[model samples]
Target chain A: MALEANYGMVGDFYTQNFTTTHTGDGDTLILNLGPQHPSTHGVLRVVVELDGEYVKKAEPVLGYIHRMHEKMGEVKTYLQYLPNMGRVDYLHALGWNWAYVGAVEKLMGIEVPERAEFIRVITCELNRISSHLLWWGAYLLDLGAFTPILYAFADRERIMDILQMVTGSRLTYCYYRFGGVSADIGEKFISDLRAFLAQFKARIPMFHELVTGNMILRGRCVDIGVLPVEMCRRYGATGPVLRGSGVAYDVRRFEPYSVYDQLDFDVPVGKAGDAMDRYDVRVAEMVQSVRIIEQALDKLPEGPFLNPDLPDRFIPEPGEVYYSVEGARGKIGVYIVSDGSPKPYRLKLRSPSFSNLSLFAELSQGTLLGDAISIMGSLDLVIPEIDR
Target chain B: MATLGQTIKSLWSMVVGMKVTGIEFFKPKLTVHYPRKEVDNLGTYRGHCDLVAREDDPLTPKCIMCGICVDNCPSGCLSLTMHVVGEGKPRPAGGAGELMLAQEVILPGSIKKAPPTGKAERVLDSFRLNYNYCSLCGLCVQNCPVSSLAWSREAYLVGRSRQEFEFDLLARLRAKAASSQGVKAA
Candidate 1:
C-alpha cells in the first residue's frame, strides 16, 4: 500500500515500461534501500530498479519524518510558531529562524537595529559554518571515510559551545526574535568566537591536507553524480549544489539580506558539478563564512538585541510576505500570510533539501549503485527538513 | 591501467592523508566522557524552566499570577491553579481568564492575600509544568513580566515514568528555599 502510494501502480513495475503488469522478462532486480539506512541519513527511503549492478531507474519516497510543520503555522500564533522553524532544518536552524522572522519583519514593516543585524549576520554565519562542518563529516562518512567525521565533529563541538552561550540551546535554536536576536552577544562571546576563528583558520589548511587531497575520496567523487548547471537550474537546486555547478548565485550576494551587502566575501563556485566539486565548494565556502564573521565582529556595535519598543502581542498587519535566506544546504524560504490576527492565516516553508533531493531521481539513473549513493550524499540532505 | 605520474600522485596523496590522521591521533582527545565526569560548563546548558525566587524571601516567587507564561506557551505544557478572592475581575496587572478553581491547594505560607484593596485578587496555588510536553522554547522566560521565569541548570533530568516528568514548580521552589534556610540556621 505504501509502495502504491509512492508509485501509481506497484505491480506494474514502472511507469516508463509498458509490461502490462509485473512480468517484464525479469531482467531487473528491485531494491528497496531504506527509510532507516545509515547512508540515507535520517529516514529517507529510495526504491531503485537495478539492471545487474547499475541502477536503471530510481524513485525517492519521502514523508518518513513529516511533522506537518506548515499546518502548525496556521493554528499557532506568530510567536508560538517561531520555534517550529528551528526543527525544520536543524543543521541550519538559524537560517530558518532568519527566514521566518525576516518575512514577519517585512510584513509588519519592523526595522531591525544595525547592531542587531550585525549580530544576526555573525551568528547566522557561525551557524552556517557549523552546518557545513556536519555535512562535511556526514558526507564523508557516507562515502566510507570515517576519520573525516571525527575531525568534523571535533570542530562542530566548539561551534556548539560558542552558540550555546547565547542561544541557550545548542541545536534547534529559537534565538532570533522578530526585530532582533533574543540575547545580546557578550564580551566573552566576541573573544570566544575570535579565538575559534583564529584557531579554525589554521585548521582549514590541515583539512585540505587530510581529506581534500586524499586519492580514495577523489576516485569515489570525481565525475560521479555529474549534475550540470542546466540540470541544477531545471531542478531548482540552490546553495552549494548549484554553486558546485559553476553558478555564483547566492541569496547573500544576489539579493543581499540583512547586512550582507555591507560585508565583503566571495561566493565560492566550482567548475564541475560532481561530488568532488561540491566538496571543494563547501570547503571554500567555509573559509568565506569565517571571513564574513570576522568582518561582522570588527563592526559589531553595542545595542539592544531584542527591540524593547516592540509590543508583547506581536500581530502583523493583514498581508503576505515571502522571505528567503541562504542556508547551508541551499535557499531557505518562509512564506507567511497574516489576517491581522495573532495567528498566521497561512504559512509555507520552502526548504532547499527538498529541491536538492529532487534532482537525485534524475541524477541517479544509469549510475552504479555505489556512485548513486555518493550522489545522494553530495546533495547534503537533512530528511526532516526535506519531509517538513 | 593508470599512467605512472597518476599512480605516483595518488600514492603521495594517500601518504599525505595518513600523515594528517597520524598528527590528529597524537593530539589529546577532544571528546568529553560524560556521566563519569560531567561537562564542567553546565552554566550555559538550558535544561528546564523554574520560577525565580524573590531576593528578600526565597520562599516567595516573583510571578504576579499574570498567566502570560501559560498563554505564551506553544505546546500548552504549563497550567496554573489560582485561588481567587471576591468576584474575580481582572487584577492590578494582566490577570488570566475565568478558570475552574476546582480544588484548593493545601500548602500553607504559599498564599499571599491582597492588602485590603477590595478588588479581584488572585493567589497562585500551584504552577504545574509538564516538562514531558515542554519544548523549552524559552517563551515562559521571555514573556515573564516580573522577570521571575529562568532556565534551571538541571541538565540530567531523568525520570522513571511519564507521571514523574510532570513538575510542580512551586513545590520545587519551596523545597529549595527550605533547604537553604535549614543550612543557614544550622
Candidate 2:
C-alpha cells in the first residue's frame, strides 16, 4: 500500500520453491514453523516441508522484525545514533556498541589510550559471558529445562551491577565516546569486579557438572544438527558456532584491536561441530572470559580516561573501513562509509547473528522437529542483531 | 571398537552434568524479597550535580550571561540574555553602552559560566531549555564553563506534549535559589 501500485515485493515470496515443485510427492508434508511460534525464536517464520519430522525443505521468511537500522543510521549523526546500536542486540549490547565505535575510531584514526583499551576489553569480555549465560539458560528452557534460566539470571545480574557502576545505565550504555571512555573507573569498581570474577570462577565448574555432562542434554544434543567444518567457513558462521567446527579463527587474535594484543587468552574449539560441541565451546569460552577479565584487572593502568584534546565536532576523512570484534553471538562488524561528514554516508552493520543464521538451511534439513529447536538455541540467535 | 569407546566417553560426561544439576536442586535458593528488602545502591550516580560554591569571592559566579554554555550545547537547550544597569539610556544588553560599575554583578561560574569580562557583564535576566531533542548525553554538563547545569536523577522526563519537554532554565534556577534560602532560614 505504501509503494507505487506498480511496484511489488518479489524474490522468495512470489517464486515457486522446492516444496511447491515436490508438492505432489507422497512422502512430503509442509509445515509452517512460525511467524508466532516460540521455537522459531523472534518473529522468524520457517516454512518446513517435512517428510515424517525430517525437514525435506526449509524456507526461512525474514523482514517481520525489520526496523531498518541501516536506514536510520543514514538520517542520524554519529553521536545521535549511539543509543540505537544498543537496540540491535540488547543482550550483547556492549559488544555491538564496541564494534560500532571501534570501526568509527579506526576510520577517523582516533587512538584510544592503553587504560581505555584495557577497560574496553574487560567490559567486552564480561558482556560476552553475560550473553553466553543467557544463551545457556534459554537453550535449556527451549529443551524443556526451566530452572537453569533462573540460575543464569542470578549470575547475569551480578555482571549488570558491575557494569552499571561505571556506565551509569543498565541495558544500553553510551559509555564509549569517539576518542575514549566517558567516565573514569573508581577503586570500588575494581574491587566489586574482582569479587564477581571469583564468584563466577567457582560457579563455572558447577555448570559443566549440571548441564554439560547431563544424560538427557547429551542425548539430545550430541551428534544432532551436525554442520561440517567446511560449511562453517562457507556460510561465514562465527563465535562458538565457528569454533565448534574446529576453526582456530578469532577476530581478537587475528585483528588485535583495543588492548586484545596485550591480553592473553585461549580460543576454545571442538572436533565434531555438533550441537553438543557448540554448547561445550560456549561453556569453555565463558571460563576463558573470566581469565581475560582477571588479567585485564591486574594490568589496569592509571591515566586519562578520555583524550582531553579531542575536538567537539569530529569529521573523518572520506574513506570506507571494515572493523570487526568477537561478540557473544559471533564476530560483530561495522562496514562504515564516511564522506568527510560528522554523520556517515553509509553505515552497514555486518551482524554475526545474520550470517550465523544462514547456516540454518543446510543444518536444519535432516534434523527432527525437536532437534531443530535445540540447534537454533545452540546457535544463539539475537533477533534484533540480525534485523539490524 | 572406536564407536564403543566414544559411547562410553559420552556416558561419562552425562554423568558429570547430572551431578551438578542435582547439587543445585538441594542448595538453598538465593532469591531476594523485592517489596520488603530495598537495595540502598539504586541511585549510585545520582545527586552528584550540585552547584559548587565559591564562598570567599562574592563575584566568583553568581550568574553572568556570557553564552559559552549556550554555544557548546549539543541540544541547543540553553538561551541566556543579560541586562546591565548602567549610567546610559535603558536598552537591550547588546545595544551601545558605557556602563557604570554596580556593587554586585552576576558572573558566569567556571562550570556552566565563564567570567563575563565584556561591558554587558551582569546577571542572567532570562534563560530557556528545549528538552524535546535532549537525549541527556551529559555533553552539556561537561561543556558548562560554570557547573550550573545538570540532569536530575528523577529521570521521568517523558511528557504528553512537546511543550512539556521545554523547560524554563530561569525558573529552575529560581526554584533552586528559593529552596536554598528556605534551607538557610530553617
Candidate 3:
C-alpha cells in the first residue's frame, strides 16, 4: 500500500512532494540516512533511493548547520572573522586560518617574517597529522572497529597537548593572526613536538599492522566506491581525495604557501581510486607530515612574530584574492573581495568537504548501502564545513 | 589449492592484526583514572579572560575603563559601564577606588586634567563578562593597553547555569581587595 498522507501538511511535504515516487508496484524504498546519524559525521541528511540493498539514486541535502559565514564576513571586520575560520573546519582549522590569512596578506602585500613562516609550517602540519589521526579512528569506527579510535585518541591527546601549548585551544584554534601567529612558540612547544614526533613514529607501524593489513578492512575497502581521477577533477576534489585517485596534486607542493616551498616533503599518491587506496594515501600522508614538521623545526629561524608595521585595525586595498591551502580533507580556499574597508566586501570559503561530498551522490550509485557508508567515511566530510 | 592458499593468506593477515592487539595488551594502559588523576596543563592553557590587578596595588585593576576591549570584542561578551564621579564627593578609598581618583580626565576640548573637585572622572562601574558567549580568542587580552586582561589559570571552572557564567569584574576586584587587606592586617 502507498503510505498516503495529506499533501498540504508540514511534515508530509517531503513524502508528498512531486518527484520520483515509488508506489507499491515499484519495490524501491526511499531512505533518509541522516541529519542526525553518527556516520554522516555531522548534521548531513542523505536521501537515498534504494533498490533492495543497493542504492539506485542518492541526493545529499545540506544547509542544516549553515551559519551564513559569507554574510558574517560582509558585516564583521577582518580581525573579527578570524574565529569563524577555525569553527568552519574544527579538524583542520589551521588550514582554513592559513587560507584566509594568506589571502589577506596577498591582497595587502604583507611580508610574513621568516620565523613566523616556519612557525606556520610546523603548527599547520602538526594540525594536519592530528586531523588525519582523528579521521583514521573515526573511519575505522564507521567500519565497526572501535578499539582503533581509542588508540587514535591516545595519540591525538598528546598532539592536542602540544598544540594547546602554542595555540591556546585544543579544537577550533584561532592561533594565526593577520600578519603572523597570535603568540610565539616557546621552548616547551618545540620540545613537546619533538617528543610527540618520536612517539608517533613508533606508533605508525602498529597502526598499519592493526588496521591497514587487516583482511576484513581490505575486503570492505579494496574494490568499493571507485572514484576516478576524471571524476575527482570534475568535482574539484583536492588533498587526500585527489591523491587517492592517483593525482599527486598537493597545494603545498604545487602552489607553495608560507614556508612549504622551503620544506621538503613528498606527496603520497594511491595507485587505485578505491576506499582502501584513500586510506593508504592518508596514512602515508601522516608520515610525510611528520617529515615536514622535522624539517621545519631544524630550519626554524629567529625574527619578530608579527609584522611591526601592520596596524591593529587593518584595512586592505580594494582588490580580490583567492588563497588555497592543502588541508587534511582537501584544498581549503578563501576568496576575499576587499573594498578598501575594514570589513570584507565579500568572503567566500571554498571548503574542501563541500566539493568532496558533492561527488558522493555520483559515486554511490549501484553500490551496496554498506559500501556507501564506507565511501562517506573515506571522504572525511566535516558537515559544518560542507554546510558553511 | 588456490582457494586454500587464499584462505591461509587471509588467516595470516588476521594473525597480523591480532599480534598488534596482543602487543598493546601487554603495553602500559593509556587511560587516565579521571577525577582521581589529572593531566598537567601548560602555561598556555587558556581557560577564561580575567582582569589583572596592578602589581603595586594588588586590589586595583590595571584597566583604565578605556573600553577598547569592550569595543574590540567580536562576540560582544564583554561589557562595562563608566561611572562619572560627581564634583566635591569624597573619592572611594582602596585599590580600584584610589585608581579612579588618580585617573586622568580628558575633556572634549583636548584638555587633560587630573582628578579633583568639579572634575568628572571615569571609573569602571561594573564590568560584565558573559563567559558563555566568550570564544576565549585572547583578542581582548592582547589589545589591553595597560595589560589589565590576562588568561585565568582556572582550568576547572564550571557553572550550573548560564547566569552563573556572567562574571562581574568590579565585584571580583573589590572582593580581591578586601581579602588582600585582611591578609595584610593579619
Candidate 4:
C-alpha cells in the first residue's frame, strides 16, 4: 500500500468490506473507486483489486445514500407516499410512479380512465427519453468526452421544459395520482413535444456521427466487459442491460402494463453483450420511446383524465400485489402487502439499478481498469435507487 | 474482433466526429450566465406553501386551525399553536369552532389584533412551518378542506439559518394583506 493518503482521513472501510474477498497482499493493489468518485456517477464505492492496469476483481459496496423509502411507505398513507416515488429514480420517476400507482390500482381494482392511460403512456415514454438522454450524456462524460453531455443537455433541457409544463417540477415529478394524473396535457404540451421529436429524430444521426461511430469510443467499448445472456439472467438484469444481452424480455411487452401493448414500438436488442452493445441499445431505445410517445399522442383518447365515483378512503382490502413497469434502466417493480390498513403493511421497491449493478463483480474481472468504468456506465447505476 | 476494413472505417469516423463538433461550434451556446439574467415564465414553479386568504376577508386565511395539514404531513415540518378563547381547556388549534388568536407572534400589517377581534370571528394563532424538512409535496394543499392552502411562486426564498426557515404563516399572510391594502389605498 502506497501510504500517502494522510489528509486526516482514517479507517480502511475497503479492507473491512473486502474481508471475504481478496484485499490484495502485495502484487495486487486495492483501490476504492469512490463513494463519490466522479466516474462512479453517484456514491458507489467499488472496491476493485488491481494488477498494474488490469482489474483482477471488483466488488460494489452500496448503502451510502440510503433514505429508507420503502420503510416510509409503511408509515405514510397511500396518498401521502405519492411524492416519494419522484425521488426514487428521478431520471425515470414516472416509471416508479406508474409502478406504485399501478400496484395500488391493482389492489383496489380501480380502473384508470382510457385518456389517463394514454396520458400516462405518453408522459412516461417521454420521461424514458429524458432519462436515457441524461444517461447517454453522463455516460460520455464518464468516458472523458465533455461536448456530448452539453449537446445531450440541450435536447434533454427541451424535454424537461415540455415535462415541466404539465408535471410542475422538472426533475422529481409527482404528477400521477392514484386514479389519474394531476393535470391534463394541454395543446401547447403536445405541439412542443411534436416539434421536439421532429428535431430530435434528426439529431440521433448526428449523435452517431459524433460519438457512436468514433474510433476512440469503439476501441474502448466494443467487445469489452461482455456479459453473457446466462450471466444477465443469473444477475436478474432487466431493461436495457438484459436487452443488450440478446434477451427481448421488456416488462412493457412481456408483462403489458399501461397502454404499451396497444402502442407499437420495437424493443432494441443487441447481438453481442458488450459495452458497445449496451450503449447502442440505449441509443436505439430512445428512438423507440419517441415512437411510443408519438403513437400515444395520436391515440390520446377523449374522456375524463381522473376516474369519477371515487371511494371515500384509499383503504385497499387485505391483499398483496406486484406491479412492474419498464424503467429507463430496467424493470421498476413495487410489491405491496396490505392488511386492510390505510398504510401498506409492507412495501418493497425492486429497482433495476440494484440488479444491474450486482453483475459488476463478474463483468469487471480480467478487464482493463478503464473498461470497468465503461461497464459501470453501461450498467446505468442510479446509486440512490440501489441504496433504497 | 475488428477486421482491417472495420479498423480503417472506425479511424475515418474520428474525422466525422470532428466535423460534427466543428459544425456545432458556430451555433449559439445553450447555457445562460445565471445571476446576470434571471429566468422568466415562472408560472409553474412550485416553491412553498402560501396561506390563501378567505374570499370574504383579506387578512384572515381560510385555515380553520383544524390542523388537517399538520396531521397529514409525512414529515413533521408543520406545527400550530393556538390560544383557546374563554374558559376552555388548551385544546388543539382546530378542535373548536371559536375564533382563535395566534399566540406569541405579533399580528401586524392587516391583522392588528393581539386580543380577539370579535366573539363570533375566528383568528389563527401561529402556524409554524419549518421549511428545512418540507418536501413541498403538496399533500397539505390537497387535504385542506377550505381550499386555503396553495403553492406560492416565491422564487427567491433564501434564509441564513435553519431557524430562519421555521417561519409563521399567519404573520406572512397578515403582511401580504397589509401590503395589498396599502397598494389599494395609494
Candidate 5:
C-alpha cells in the first residue's frame, strides 16, 4: 500500500493517461535526458516521453552515487559515524549534524544546558542561511546568471569564517558531539559572529535588488512548475517547497528542538505554488534566519557546551525515534532503531530531495524542455542528497 | 504579431544589461587574474602555518612530546620524537645533528589512520605524508591539538621527490626556529 501510494505508473498522455478504464492506441516516443548529460544538474537521468517537445511523461532514474550511508551508520559507533553525517548533503552539513546529534541525544535522554542550546540554534540558523545562499546562487547559475553566485559566495564566506573558529573545519564540520558540541566558544567567536551578523544583515537586501526583482528571472519562474497545495500534502513534501504552496507545515515549527522553542521567527509562505514562489520563499527564509540568529545571539547564555553525563560509548535503550530538520532543499529525517547497543540496529533516511525529485515528473509533463530545467533549478535538488 | 513585440522587449533588456556591465567595466577591475598575480599572500584569510620560537626562553619547551596532538591528528602526517642522550639511534654530539626516529606522525588529512598495533609506542614514530594523494582539505592541521601541522601557503606543492614533501614537520619546525636565531645572532 505504501509502495502504491509512493509511486504510480503513467504512459504517454493522450487524455487517456491515468484513466485505467479507457482503451486507446497511440505511438509513444521515449526521450532520455542525461545519466551523463550536463543539464540534469548532477548525474541524474530522466526518461521523458515527448509529443514534439511537449513532455507527455517523465521518469527520474536515480541510485548512481548511492554509498549505503544508512548501512554504514548501523556499523560505526555513535562518535565514529559523526563525520559521515556531513557527507549526506555537504551544502547543509550543519543541519544534517543537528538532526543526527538530536536523534542521539533523544535516545540517550541528555538535556543540553541553556548556553549550548542557544549556540546550537545560532549555528544551525547560520548554516541554514549558508545553505539557502548556495541554493540561490546555484539556482541563478542554472538559469544562466553568473554575478549572483559571486554575491552569494561573498556572504557565505562570512558564515564559513564564523563556523571555522569554533567548529575548526569549514565545508564538512564534525563539530557537534553526541550530547552537545565538542568545544566551548571563546570571546573572539562571539564577537566575530556579531560582526558577521551585522554585515550580513546589511548585504541581504542586495540579493533582493539583484535577482528577485530581475525581469528575466521573474518571466522564467512566475507560473512554471505549479505543484498545487493538495499534491504537496499527498507526496509529504516539507520545507520551502511545501511552504511555498501555502501549507503551514515546517519541521522546526512543528517539532521544535535545540532551543528553537525559546527563540521567535516567522516561517515565510507564498500563495502561488509555482517556481517563483519557491524562489521567493527561500529568499524570505534567509531574512527570517537572520532574524532568528539575532534573537539567539541577544539571549546568549553562559554554561557548559557538553553534557556532564555523556558516556564514552553512546549506547541507547532498545527503542526507535525519527529526528528531522528543515535542510536547505527540504526536510532531512533520520530514522534510528537501537537494540541497546553501541551501533544502531537498522537506520533509514527520509531524504527530502528524493521525494522532491519524484514530483519532477508531475511538473515536467505538459511543459517545455526549458521549463523542465527551470523547475529543476527552482527545486534546488542536490543530486548527492537525493542519491544518499 | 507576438514576434515583433517580444523581439523589441528582448532588445531593450539586452541594452539595459550591457549598459550595467559597461559601467562595471570602467570601475577598477575586481576580476582577479589569479594565475598572473605574483603576490602569493592570501591576505588575512589563513593561508599557511609559520613555526615561531620564543626569544626569552631560547629553547621554549614548545612540545613535551605529549601524544594529544598525535591522537587528535585526523590524517597521519604529524610525527614527534624526544631524544634520550644515547638510545637505539645515537645522537650526533657535533656538526649537523643526528638522524633519529620520532614519536608522532602529523599528516594533513591526506591518508587514512593506520590502526595502531598495541605494541607500537603511543608517541609519534615517523610522519610520512603521501603528497601524491593529498587533497589539502586541512582537517589534520585544524584538529592538531598543538597547532603545528599547517596548510603551506605555497599553493604549488607539486614537489619532485616524495621524501622532500615528507619531512619530520615538528623537528623541521624546531630546526627552523634554531636557524632563524643563528641568522639573527650573525
Candidate 6:
C-alpha cells in the first residue's frame, strides 16, 4: 500500500508533464527497465509508467557510460584522436572511423587513393552487415528466441575474422587513417571475403525460414509500436528506423561519401512502419551491403594503402567540416572545428542512436510492456553511442 | 473450418522452422573448448607492441631513442628515457658492438637519427609501456621510424596485478641481448 502511494505520486507527476492520464482505478506502477538490464542493449535506463500491463508513459535516461569523447577530441591531437572513434560505437566502429577521417580529409583538401576508397567501402559494408546480424540475434533474444543468436554469432565471428586481417583489432577497429586506410587488403583477405559471401548467401535464406517466417515472431513484431514517418522526421531518426517507417532515407544513398557514389545498391524501404518492418529493413539492408562489398572487391584496384606524402603529424588548416557516414544504427556525423592546431578547437559527434532513442517515449505510449521491448529492439539503440 | 486450417498452417510453419535446427544438429559444433583447444587461425590478431631485435645482431634494439612513438601514443602508454652516454666512459661492456649493430640496422633511410655530437651518444635507457591503458591501436608501431616496435602475438598474456603490465621494453631488450652474447661466448 505504501509502495502504491509512492508510485501514485510519481505517476501523477509524469501524467502532468507527459499529459497521459491513467484510465485504471489503481495507481500506475513505475518500472525502471535498465541502466544494467540486458534487453536495453547497454546501460540505457527506461522509466516506464504502466497502468496494469499497458504503458502510459516511457522516458529513457542516458549517460551511464559517457566518457566525454567530444572533450577528449579537443585535448588530443588530430592523429591521436583517431582511436576514440572506435570506442564511440564499438559495433559499427569503422563508420565512426570513416566519419572522423572523412571530416579531417575534407578540411585538409586531401584526396584518398581510388584503391583505398574501394577498401573503405568494402570494410565499412562488412561492418554494417555484422552490426545488423548482432541486432537480428539480440532482437530475437529480446522476443524470447534463443537459437537465432547462436546462428547469428556463427556468421558474425567469420565476418570479424575477415575484418581482423586488415583492421588488426576485431571489435573496436581503428583501421581508417585521414588520407587512407591503415593497411592494404591482401589476396588472402579478398579470397576469404569471396568464400564468406558465397557461404552467407545460403545462410541468409535459412535465417529467414527459421526466424522471419515463424508465426510467433510475426505475431509479436507485426503491427506493434507503429512509428509513422512523421515522428521519424520530427525526432530526426535515420538508418533502419526511418526506413522501417517507409522512408527510404539512408545517409549512404542521400549523402554518398567515399566510393559509395560509384557502388550500386538498392535502399530497402518498408511499407507498414512497424517493428516487423524494421526487422525486414535491416535484413534487406544486410543483403544490399553484401552486394556492395561484392562489387567493391571485384573492382579493388592496386595502389599504396597509405598516402606516401602525408606527414606524420597530420595538421589540417584552420577550418571546420561536417562529415556523415551511415553506421549500423543510423547516420554518424562528426563535426570538427580546427584552429590550425594539431588538436581540434571543438569536436561534436551527432550519434544516430541518440535521436532514434528520443522518439521511444512517444512510440511506447499506450502500448503493452512486452511490445515496448520489441520497439526498443527494433530501434537497435547502442547506449555508448547515445551517451558519447 | 477456417480456424482449423489457420492452426494447421501455423503448425506447418513451426515444423519448417524446426527443420533448420534439425539439419544443424549433425553439423560440426562451432564452440572451441578453450585452454585445451584454440582457434586454428589468429587472422591478424594484434596483442601489444614489443621492441623487435635486430636481424643481424640479436643483442641490439633498433629503437634509436627517438621519441616519435612516445610523443604520438594517444593513451600516453609509451614512455622513453634517453641516457646520453659520455665520450670517454667505457660504454657499458658489450654496448659498443650493440650500438654499432643498432646504428647499422637503423641508420639507412630512417627519418629520425641521433646527432653526431662527439660529446654524447643517445642510448635508450628505459622504454616503458603500460599495457593496461594501451588501446592496441598500433599508432606507436606505425609511427616508429626504424620499425623497431611490432605486435607481440602474445594472446594469452595475463598477470595477477596491474603492476605486471608496466613493461620495461629496454630492460627486456638488454636481457635478450645479454643472453644471446652469453650463448655466443659459450
Judge candidate 6 against the unseen true structure and give its global Cα lDDT, from 0 to 1. 0.85
How many angstroms is residue A214 displaced in model 6 relative to the true structure, after the best TM-score fit? 0.4
Instruction: List, residue by residue over A1-388, the lDDT tens digit for candidate 2.
Output: 6244537533455245653467537777877777788765688777777888778767777788898788767655566567677778888878888888888888878888878888888887888899899899999989987767887998998888888787766676657776777778888889999998998889887776766666678778999988887898898998889998888789989888788888889999988999999998999999999999999999999898787677555568899988888888888888989898656899899888888889897788778888888888888987777777
Once model 1 is optimally superposed onto the true structure by TM-score, how far is the C-alpha of residue B14 displaced, in angstroms? 1.4
lDDT tens digits, residue span A116-213, model 1: 99999999999999999999999899889899888888889999999999888889999989889888898999999999999999999998898788
Model 6 stretches astray by more than 4 angstroms: A1-26, B87-119, B175-186
RMSD of 6: 6.6
B6-111 per-residue lDDT for model 2 (tens digits) = 8888788767766676877898876767657655554544322223233553223344444544544433455556666644332332211212111111122322
Report the lDDT tens digits of candidate 6 across residue range A346-377. 99999999999999999999999999999999
> Which parts of model 1 have CA positions greater than 4 angstroms off?
A1-24, B86-118
Candidate 3 segments exceeding 4 Å error: A1-18, A21-25, B85-120, B180-186
Is model 2 an incorrect, acceptable, medium or high docking prediction? incorrect
Q: Output the worst ten-in-a-row residue range by lDDT, candidate 4 chain A.
A: A1-10
Judging by TM-score, tell me the better candidate of 4 and 5. 4
Q: Report the poorest 10 consecutive residues by lDDT, candidate 3 chain A.
A: A1-10
Clash number for every model? 0, 18, 0, 3, 16, 0
Tens-digit per-residue lDDT, A69-152, candidate 4: 999888777877888998999889899999999999999999899999999998898899889999999999888889899889
Worst 10 residues of 1 chain A by lDDT: A15-24
lDDT by residue (tens digit), candidate 6, B1-186: 999998888888899889999999999988888988987666577888989888887656887765667656777777666566676342221112211211212112222443234766767667788888898888888888779998877778889998999888877777878887899899
Report how far residue A280 has shifted in candidate 1, in Å.
Answer: 0.7
Against the native complex, each candidate's DockQ, computed on alpha carbons, is 0.41, 0.22, 0.36, 0.34, 0.08, 0.37
* Model 2 residue A93 CA deviation in Å: 2.1
